[model samples]
Target: MSISRLHIERVRNIQTAALHQLQPFNVFYGQNGSGKTSLLEAIHILATGRSFRTHIPKNYIQTQQADALIFAQAHQEKMGIQKFATGEQLIKVNGDSIATQGQLARLLPLQLIDPQSTDLIDNGAKPRRQLLDWLMFHVEPDFYHAWQYYARALKQRNTLLKTKRQPTLADLEPWNQMLAEYGELLHSQRLSVLQQWQTFFLHDLQMLLPEIAVQIDYRAGFHPELGLANELQHAHSKDVERRYTEYGPHRADLRFKTALGDADVVLSRGQKKLLVMALKLSQIAMLHASNKETVVLLDDLTAELDSTAQRRLIERLSQLGSQVFLTTLDHVAVQQHLNDLSISYQLFNVDKGQIHAVEPTIYN
Candidate 1:
C-alpha cells in the first residue's frame, strides 16, 4: 500500500500543509529545523498512530498550540481488486480534537530508517527488541494481542511483588505461571521470525556489507535449573529490595555478532549504520517476499554512510518493489548515487516549515 495524499496542520513547525499525488520515490530537501523531519514523523504517526520520535503528543503540537492534526489516504491492490483506505485519527488536549492521524500498518508496512538507527547497535537492547517486535506484530497476527496481555500481566505481577514482602512461592505461583507462559510464547515467536529472516534476507544483507557475518541470538530466561520461575524465585530478595520484578522476557535482550567481532565493539560508526540499514533492508525484502507492498520512510539518508554503502542501499531499496520517502539536506548526497536512475521520485523544497514541490527541471 502507498499514500496517495497527506494533509497536515498544527504539527510541529508546519502550521498547515497538504501534499498529494506522491511518486514512487520522494526526496524532501531542507535546512535543519525546517520541518523536514516533522513531515516524516507525520507519516509515521499516520501509519502507527504514534510518533516514533517523541513520546509526548504535546511536543508534536507547535509550541503554544493546543493540538496537531494529520490526514492521509492509502491505496492498495488485493485479489486483483484495487481499494482505497481512509481514516481520521485525532489527538485532543483538554477535551478538544486539535490534532489527529491514522495508518493502515498491515496493508501499509513501513520501515523507517533514520539517523537514530545507529543507536540500534551503539545503545541499549530496547531498540533491537523493538526491531523483532515490530516485525512480529506485522507478520504474526496473534503476537500483538499476546504481547499486550503479557505486558499487563507482567505489570500486575511486578506490582504484587512490590507491595507484598516475604510472599511465599504459593503466593507468586500464579503470576509466575502466567509470566512464564507468555514470556516463552513471545520468545518463540521472535525466534521464528528471526529464523525466517536469516534464511531468506540475511544473504541479501551480506551482499550489502560483505565483510561482516551478522548473527541474531534470542535469549529469554533460557537457562537450565534457573528458568523463568527459578529466576524469579532467585531474585525474590532483590525484587523486594528494589520493589519490582528483576528478570523475565521484559529483561530479555538480543545479541548481534559478526565474523570480525561483536557488533557492539568492533563496528565503526559507518559500519553500525550499515548494519541497521541492512536490517531494515532485510525487513523490506521479507515483506516483499510475502507479496506485501510497503512504503519506506528514511530521514537523513546520507549520514554516516560512505558512497559504496549508499549505492548498495539504493540498489536494495529499488529491488524491493516499494515506494520510498527520503529526506536529506544536501542534493549532492543523493545526486551521486541516484543520478540517472529511472525510478520515479518527487522532489520537495522545505523552508522554515513551509514546503513546495520542486520540478525535475531544477535538477536539470
Candidate 2:
C-alpha cells in the first residue's frame, strides 16, 4: 500500500509536517540538516513502528517534546501511531487498536537500503540473521509464533541458569524441551526458507552484482551430529557458568564465502555493498511476488554506486512496480543523472525542517 497522505508531529526537527498526494517515485532533495532524511525515517517509523536510523524510538521525538505522532492514509486504510518519550508506542490501524508489530508489518512491508546496510556483510551475524528472519516472517505463517515461543523459553532458561540456587535437571527439563522443539522448528523453517531463496535468489543476486562471487551458507546454530537437544545437554555446565543459553537458534548466522575465500577477507567495501544490495533486492522480490507493491526506502541511493550502477538499480526497482522513496543532498548532480536516465519522478524540497512538493520544472 502506498501512502497517499502522511502527517508527522514532533519528529526530529519537524514540529509538524504533512505531505499529500504522494507518488510511486518520491524524491526528497535538500541541503544538509534540512530534515530530508528525517522524512524518510518518519515514513519508515510509520511502516515498521521502528526507526531505521536509531534503535531508540524515544530519541526520534524532538528534544523537549514529550511524544511524537504519525498518521498515514494509504490505499484508503488509515494507520496512526503515538510514540511516547517513555518508550511506549501505540498503533491503531483503521481505527482499531493494534498491539503486534507483525500486524503492522503485514500491512506495510518495506525494504531499506542505506549507509549502514553494508553491515549486513561487514559486521557480525546479527544483521544477517535479522535480514533472513524478516524474509521468513513474511513468507512463513507460523514463523512468528514459533520464534516468539523460542525467545521466551530461552529467556526463562537463561534466568534459571543465573539463579543463585542452581537449577536441577527437573527444573531445566521443561525449558530445554521447549527450546529443543522450537529450535528445531526454527531450524527446519530457516532451512526451508534458504532453499526457496536458492531457487531464484542466486540468479537474482548475480544480476545485481555480476562481478562479485560471494556465497551464502547457513549455520543451523548447533553441530549437525550432536543435534539441538544433545548440544543443549552437553553445554549445560558451560551455559550455567556463562549465565546464558549458548547453542540454539540464537547463535545462528549466515556465513559469507567468496571465490578468494571468506568475503570479509577478500571483497572490497564496494563489493560488500553491492552484495548486500543484491541480497536485499532478492528479499524484496520474494515479498513483491505476492505483496504486488512493496514500499522501498533508499537513503543516499547513489552513495556508493557509479552513474551506470545507479541507473541500473533505479530501473530495476521501477520494473518491480514498487514505490520508492529516495533522498539526495546533491540535488543538481542527482537530477541530472536521473534526467540522463530519462525517467519521470516527483521531487520534494526540504529546508529548515519544512518540506514542500516542488514542481518538476523547478529542476530546469
- The residue ranges of model 2 lying beyond 4 angstroms of the native Cα positions read 336-344, 362-364
> Worst ten-residue run, lDDT, model 1?
78-87
Task: lDDT for model 2, please.
Answer: 0.83
TM-score of each: 0.87, 0.95
Tens-digit lDDT track for model 2 on 1-364? Answer: 7778889998999888988888777888888889988988988888888898788877889998889999989987999888888889899999999888678888888889887887888789898899889889889999999999999999999999888466666788899999999999999999998888765567666887777666688998898677888888888788877888899998899988877898877887887777777787778777777764678888887677787667777777776767888998756666665566566667899898898888765344
Give me the candidate number with maximum lDDT: 2
lDDT of 2 at 247: 93
